[model samples]
Target chain A: MRVRKLIYLLWATAVFLAACGGSGKMEVTNAWGRTSPAAAANGAFYMTITNNTGQDDKLLSASAAACATVELHEMYMRENDVMGMRQVPDGYIPLPKGQTVELKVGGLHVMCINKQQEFMIGDTIPLTLQFEKAGTMEVTAEIRDSAEMPANMPGMQHGGG
Target chain B: MKQLLPLFAFLLLLLAACQSEPKYYGTLWPNPQEVADFTLTGTAGPVSLSDYAGKVVLLYFGYTFCPDVCPGTLADLGYVVRELGRDADKVQVLMITVDPERDTPEQLAEYMSHFHPSFVGLSGTEAEIAAIAAEYGVFYQRHEGTAATGYLVDHTARVFVIDQQGKYWLSFPFGMMREQMKADLQNVLRRG
Candidate 1:
């Protein structure tokens, strides 16, 4: 009877956890980065962040030991199809409650400039992300070749032109 | 009246076939622009459009500091050329820098070499660059940034295909497919 009762309690806990959401906190996933070309002084990283909390949060900054500086930037096009990439002015990206924020190519991204080490395919770079409410968290971004990435990523793999 | 009906049906079929002809990947200019010869300094010293007299030119405007857009566009072009294989030698890519103050001829060349060894980077005096840009219908401007971040340049991202005869052939808008471009380039080569 005690064993059966324990089993019931375990099942209840599993259900409770599921009801609360798989990860009821700020979480990062799909963390990936691109390898820097030989003459490239900079590299880029991308990922998706999910805010599974009831309160809003803000990503204040990011840091990588491999780079001299890490800046949040966006790639956009002006009128007449003029393309521009610039740093995010406020230096913070908002994370609304229960929403997911994606950082992808040609969109929001993390720019690692003046790299101390080259970002190569299959290598992992350690990054630290700071948030207003969620505090700081460290994540690893797996470096990938452009060919291995998606069409929207740094690699442009498409039908031959 | 019976004879006229059959003639009209045949005409309709011919029109449909014409419309079905494979479309070029890039936008075909209604009136292709005629490009004038221009000279600029590259890593290997003075270079001119006239130098590649009988070769097709893939012209683009960008800068080295551009981490995403420029590299992505160039990579797509590299793939297109690679798809051409032996025919790639008949084509040349010229990347003109919009940020003259920062992108010297040497810097531009070094940056471009990362994309494709055959790619060449061009830089010239402010007036010289402007004249060439104007002729190509390219517009560009700079945006300020932090001291550490330097600045950003916004410029036209279209790819211009200049035929071997030095005439503007087509404009490939940003985000065009490589396969479509390859098909069009193949047709261009076949004509020659």
Candidate 2:
């Protein structure tokens, strides 16, 4: 009986570690993509990254076959009040344990440049997100129309054009 | 049929008489104030607000990196400018880039060309941009991060109008109609 109890305790510990730190345990939610028409030539993708582990992890990089290059970017406003945006260097995004990070309009975003093919609504673009510890996870982002409001940003107006 | 023709002619005459009178479509914004004079770099060269003293001026503040709102507003302004025709010469459209760090004069020139040649693009140092934005009561904020790239900037989306005397006249919110803008310009010019 003592031996059996010890085995059960060891198994439970292994299961808990596997659930907290392993690649299969991390969670991602609210992924989306927008592809312009063939003529527009540029598109953007957005999503939220959630880290479920007790330990922190980092998002190393991302890749997609749909575009010539995939870049991470964020817009900036200076103390003097000018606004600008530039590409993120290193492409490593930090994710704290049990926290959620969002990429949306007027915020951190992923830019897909020089599209080889156009993405239309109701279609999905296959992407792979590389993490420092989570290895690589495959994701499919749904293409949305330009007029579509992001589900995360409530009270945002539409049909401004 | 012959008896009805005379009645129709009388109705047409009455309509023509009524059309000769100008219709005042309600005020744009109540209690409008005049915009102050300020100097900034333009696509052509250094230009002051006073340079457009005698013309109706449409002024909007935005940055080049804005993916949607800036371009859409400029496109609409281009359409309205074209609709004005010869009167377009009587009006000035000013686009002030809120992002001065990257929007050099050359960049401003290139970006303005994407919409209309007649439209003017302006950029200046952070201090200058902030001073003008404050004077205009525009609000903007920048998010900070260690991404080695820039952060995001959120800003107000109000377009201001200046009358012939360089005084703040009215304001158009986002998605204003071109016809409404044309009418407002005509009204301002007539008042002058």
Best by DockQ: 1
Give stretches of model 1 more than 4 Å off: A1-18, A21-25, A53-55, A117-123, A143-161, B1-21
Q: Looking at candidate 1, what is the lDDT of residue B163? A: 87
lDDT of 1 by residue, A1-161 (tens): 99999999999999888676654789899888866564566777899999986578998999999878998888787776777778887888899989999887667888887777756668999999999988999999998644332343232322222
lDDT of all predictions, in order shown?
A: 0.80, 0.68
Residue B98, candidate 2: Cα error in Å is 1.4
What digit string (tens of lDDT, one per residue) describes model 2 on residues B98-173?
7677667776666666567777889888898899989877876665533332454567666777888777747655
Q: lDDT tens digits, residues B124-174, model 1?
A: 888999999998779998888656568778898888889888889677777
Instruction: Assign candidate 2 its CAPRI class.
Output: incorrect
Where does model 2 exceed 4 Å of error?
A1-161, B1-29, B144-149
lDDT of 1: 0.80
Chain A only, candidate 1, TM-score:
0.76
Per-residue C-alpha lDDT of model 2 across residues A13-125, encoded as one tens digit per residue? 99987776653456876678653444333356778898876678988777889877777766444332333455656666788998888876545777666566756668899
Error of 2 at A132 (Å): 22
Instruction: Report residue B107 deviation for candidate 2 (angstroms).
Output: 0.2
